[model samples]
Target chain A: MSDFTTWDILRNLLLAARWTVLLSLVSFIGGGIVGALLLFARTAKGKAGPAFVKTYVELFQGTPLLMQLFLAFFGLGLFGIDVPAWLAASVALILWSAAFLTEIWRGCVESIARGQWEASASLGMGYVQQMRHVVLPQALRIAVPPTVGFSVQVVKGTALTSIIGFVELSKAGTVVTNATFEPFKVYGLVALIYFCLCWPLSKSSQILERKLNVAHRNH
Target chain B: MNYTFDFGWLIEYWPVLLKGIGITVELTLVGGVLGVALGIACAWARALGPGWLRPVVAAYVELIRNTPFLIQLFFIFFGLPALGLRMSELQAANLAMVVNLGAYGCEIIRAGIQATPKGQFEAGASLGMSRLQTFWYVVLIPALQRIWPALSSQIVIVMLGSAAVSQIAAEDLTFAANFIQSRTFRAFESYFVATLIYLALAIALRQLLRGLGWTLFPKRTAR
Candidate 1:
């Protein structure tokens, strides 16, 4: 076994962090699509649709994401589906994101007043039209800060994907640490990389919230 | 490929699941209580401590907030031993939880502090309460009361996230699931059951925290 220098460890981690970023992007984008559909269902014209979506959100939100990833990794295999770490991690993460994003977006939508909805209805606009022209425009404002805040969470969350053998930044940190016997240097570097990724997002999210004047204490 | 799901482990491994649940609860309790207390101090230092200390606290908050808890745990559990600071698995897990939760709890509590009107602090001073007394009676309590709901959610999030603590062999709920599955060849069933138990815990915890929040600010909630 050759000695792995700090530079070598950092180099390998930088390569793996790419996958972390990629997984975060995939999960966020996939989640956005799935979440939007769920949000619509949540607000659809009936008690049943909204009720079902509520349970769906609660189920996802209430359980540990680790368990979800485990199930996705093993459950599919039990059902005769060949599960790769990448595929299982992606699917689990996307579902997790979808549940959370739906809840976040729903909260944003709910923040829009009843008067706006009624006014839109009185103007001969249907539900979809009302959302398009009035409701969403306003809800998107309140949604931006929290959504950005949640994205920070999503980035941090990608680290958990390493558990199922996805070889992301965290896993890379472990591999390098084992090779170099320099856990502090390797893991510190890993933490630094994650910080670099997340700090800008955290800072900008606060700035955006201030700009949008949506930094309400309650949220 | 004929796959059969058997739950014989439920009866045979009841004690294992119970033990895991017990350990998880203990970790959450310790982590939640100590973490919130640490957060209160950090938030205070950030808001009104000596000018020299503000930047230090800010850095701590930012660093922890930005990194994943898993890395923090790994660094403490695996990396610290390299530096000749050794701890048991349980110690490492609890320390990581406290540190991670403290960072987040600090942010949440600091937001509440920032929202407190200046007049309130002045009121405390005018009443001849010492600075420390004023902060305790006026600033910290009310801020905590106001932010309790958000803090409650954070506690649950930390608890849920504790599942990852098992990765380091802390013998929490997730560890038990992995243990039982390995013994029974029923990974799916084990994990599925674990998820349900976690779901129940999360829901129950949220309710408990909400109740705790109301009790923390009886005056505010009485209105």
Candidate 2:
């Protein structure tokens, strides 16, 4: 019912983009912490920890993130735990991101040769010490590219939070579309913003992979 | 917390849920088949096709890969009519999934194509095969064989991501959950059931794809 010029739309969307960036950062950082813990548990000596982490990762990965967000928003409310959209979105995205991150990191950690573990043990190094001293440092290097790459996923994922009523870029786009009746321009701009945010991360991930491989070859 | 869970709505809502599941599977089947076909074409173009086409294919792949599926769907469903391009919700959803999976599948298939041995191409040339013939009979099959697992995983991802189509009222499985919850006021139960169904679908799809891979690439299984 109001006139919205191109600049008006762009300004509103840009303002909302901050929430998108913040949510991505929160989920990525939180997911990384949780994923690291799961990675340790997954690689720990014993059956239970690894198995539990495996199931945890599988369950999260197997379902849609939208369903997860719905369950978080409504499921939490069912128990009288009134959750705001941002909290629900953050929690669901964190858990989902953690699942993928743990799996990605597990692959990286496992790629460290078995000899490294055996040699560390022979040197009287404990599991934690071997991981801390040798395996993780090496794994961290390989992990950087994919981790940065997955950050793009985290950013794209923040788009889903809009479905749960979070006033992020995508949601803002929808609201602006209603106000301006310009769904084409609004959604196109939304896609462009997402592309700008994600392409650099995707490109860097590819470059990092190539760079790391060169370093490995030179070694 | 003293919250009593009621799945009583299931009896009444079974048909709606069934229809939803049916649509979701239909979307997946159509999206998966057509998507992989488009991917194969793009992969060929990027990897082995003419010089002018590679950048064009690369730009499409990069654009799709870097954006979220939801915006793409919104663009197609809500945004496209401004240019006189119109489609039904279901059509838009299917098109979105196909386009989404094609980009991902292109990259995956390209990786496989890139991994092909240089000797294979020369061998094909010596066998009197044209470049397209060589790609078809010699390179493409083995490349697909090498990347079947990865491609299958991407399809599953695209299938899961299809849940977002419900935002446009496309009546997929997630839409079923939303419907049942609104009617029953059993939001958690409805979503919980839907989540489990998705898990089942994902697992089943993975297994089905694994079997399909073995059938398609018998040599892999033999080896």
Candidate 3:
């Protein structure tokens, strides 16, 4: 009854996959920037800074990403803001990813040891200088694997944005499924596409983890 | 800024909200228990079971870990019907959660198992214990103790992700939020309340898991 050949479905889903990749990139980059700021605040030697960052991370981490998308989509509407689905999805994902990234990075930062801080302080280094020069370089090396690993999550998260009507790969699968009456094939292709996107990231994260931890392995 | 925030719909929709929460909890309980059990079996397969099973379990872990939970749910709920395997939305949701968590739990539990000192296995052998008995009595408990925190986090994560089950009309907590919003046209309020309830549930689940850890591994708590 429908004219959606296999090629047609594949082509449409591929087109939508572009948006999935783009959204993942946008949120990962945006979340990285915000997460870095939160990481600094969280690691800084102050009561309020750590507490505030903690609450922000906990709030985002505790709630469902779907609910976060809904709030961004509709809560903004209550304030006379014309929120588009893409905007809501991007903003919500950025915030959500930032929370996780901040927490992940906090662990990396904390692993740098209190001795490093004391030694830096003994050299008359301020907190900023110590962090910029002494701590971050070490933390950055440790953080790379986990950060890359989290990109897989960001990519998968873009799937949830389809519910908010962003028309990404998963949404395209649904649309194509309706048109072609081939739910199994369409969804199977969708899963295959996601696995293709995600597997490399997961593999590289494992490789990076092993490679980066070589120094500690001897200990 | 003259908009008034009204939550009068809460009075009427409380039952719906309660049912949603109940279902969400039920999903988490069943998913957590079965998923971890499946994880244990897979972990054993990968770590100590037959050599042929290692690659099979590895592939399953990688496949589930790499894909989004929603697509897995969709495959089970919508895609499987094409092959003549039919089930209710809740069953599909439960199955998806179990599958998703099992993959993750396998990885986490495997890490714990790998950390087991070689001496422990030999000690079990010297004690005249069979391989399975050695695994059950000497290996699994300590391994579980080591990875309990990570497993707890994954379970909580699976619970939060269960929100996606609502997309297939599984009547989860997120579904309640969607239903209430559609009925009352209070989209923001409905989602806001649901989000808070999710936050509460997450906190409660974490605490419960921590308590369970204490109960299960009393030696660790005593330390």
Candidate 4:
């Protein structure tokens, strides 16, 4: 029964909002790095590399982010290691985002016509050189829109980390609501804050998607 | 440290796991079917409804699309109770799932609807068909047939997303994993099993949707 004003609640939520932004950045960056390697492995065209990467992507994408967070938090304890909330949340999101980003970028890489690889090979470029020079440049353009769109997913995904007591925006809303006993106002603000964080990226993703579609059509 | 992984716990708790899997499948199937129906309606309204209604539907789509499903579940489960609307966790979870899956499905299906050629509608109109008849006979079914793959994939995504409902204690597979982990202190093993269960369910659901599509759209089978 605390008489906390709406402004006080929002002020606290704004502070917690910083963690949400930080977590999204960490997960997206970490996932981007891991996902790049995974995309490479998936397209490596070897005996077992493709299969291994396929399994990795399927494992993370097929399950829930909440379960992934729980496993990262509590599962590590079973291996005689205790992870902090920050590390656990980051690790789980990185893995989750990696699975998705790998799939997305793989689509980009694969969309490059077969002739480009063949032509690169004919010029005596090794696999690494061909990928580094020829394929990646072309694929990066096709990859931009989807990657931006997927970032929205990554941002929303960080909210799941709050389940493990990570104290992001959603968790902070819970804390504020508990103190104020104003679930409607608290959650409405929570939704609005999330919308503010996500709407710009969402709009840019649509714009990028349309622009890319036009470019692809013209080409 | 000599720690033995007791998969014996898994063996003993097999029935609980099975029951959990059953509940997960039930929720996903029920939610997926209903969500698709809701999606089609919303998509139709957004695409063909009166001008004023279209923007409102668009706003609904955007609002739900950008927010996390977990928070939506909380708002329904926790927030509603404050307004004297008491729902069990399962009802709240299902309602949230339906709302969430519908918004996504609406977007995908609306794209499909727009892709339908205008000529098809003209042909239906030339036959003296009413607007509803033209939409149903000429537009809706054919549009869905073309977009069946995307629509089915979205259903699988919905099924996978159902795992988020566990936070409200829906006793889905993830919830069961949480219970098993606490009881046996084998969090890894518990979640590994749960993940496998989810994978199996996803594959099965995809197959089921494919079968349903084949049955519904026999003429499109050649494609």
Ranked by lDDT, top first: 3, 2, 1, 4
lDDT per residue, candidate 4, A128-162, as tens digits? 99999999998998898889988989889988888
**Could you tell me the lDDT of residue B115 within candidate 1?**
81
Q: What is the C-alpha RMSD of each candidate to the true structure, in Å?
A: 1.9, 1.3, 1.2, 1.8
Model 3 spans with C-alpha error above 4 angstroms: B220-223
lDDT of 4 by residue, B134-173 (tens): 9888899988998889989888887888888888899888
All candidates' chain B TM-scores are 0.96, 0.98, 0.97, 0.95
Candidate 3 share of real interface contacts: 0.87
Clashing residue pairs in candidate 1 (N, C-alpha, C atoms within 3 angstroms): none
Please list the residue runs of candidate 2 whose C-alpha ends up more than 4 Å from where it truly belongs after superposition. Answer: B220-223
Interface RMSD of 4: 1.7
Better of 1 and 4 by lDDT: 1
Worst 10 residues of 3 chain B by lDDT: B214-223
Q: What is the DockQ for all candidates, taken in turn? A: 0.77, 0.87, 0.86, 0.64
TM-score of chain A of each: 0.95, 0.97, 0.98, 0.96
**Tens digits of per-residue lDDT for model 2, B1-223:** 7899999988999999999999999999999999999999999999988999999999999999999999999999999999999999999999999999999999999999998889999999999999989998899998999899999999999999999999999999999999998888999999999999999999999999999988888875344
Considering the two chains of model 1, state its CAPRI-style docking category: medium
Provide the TM-score for each candidate, comma-separated.
0.97, 0.98, 0.98, 0.95
Supply fnat for every model shown.
Answer: 0.89, 0.84, 0.87, 0.59
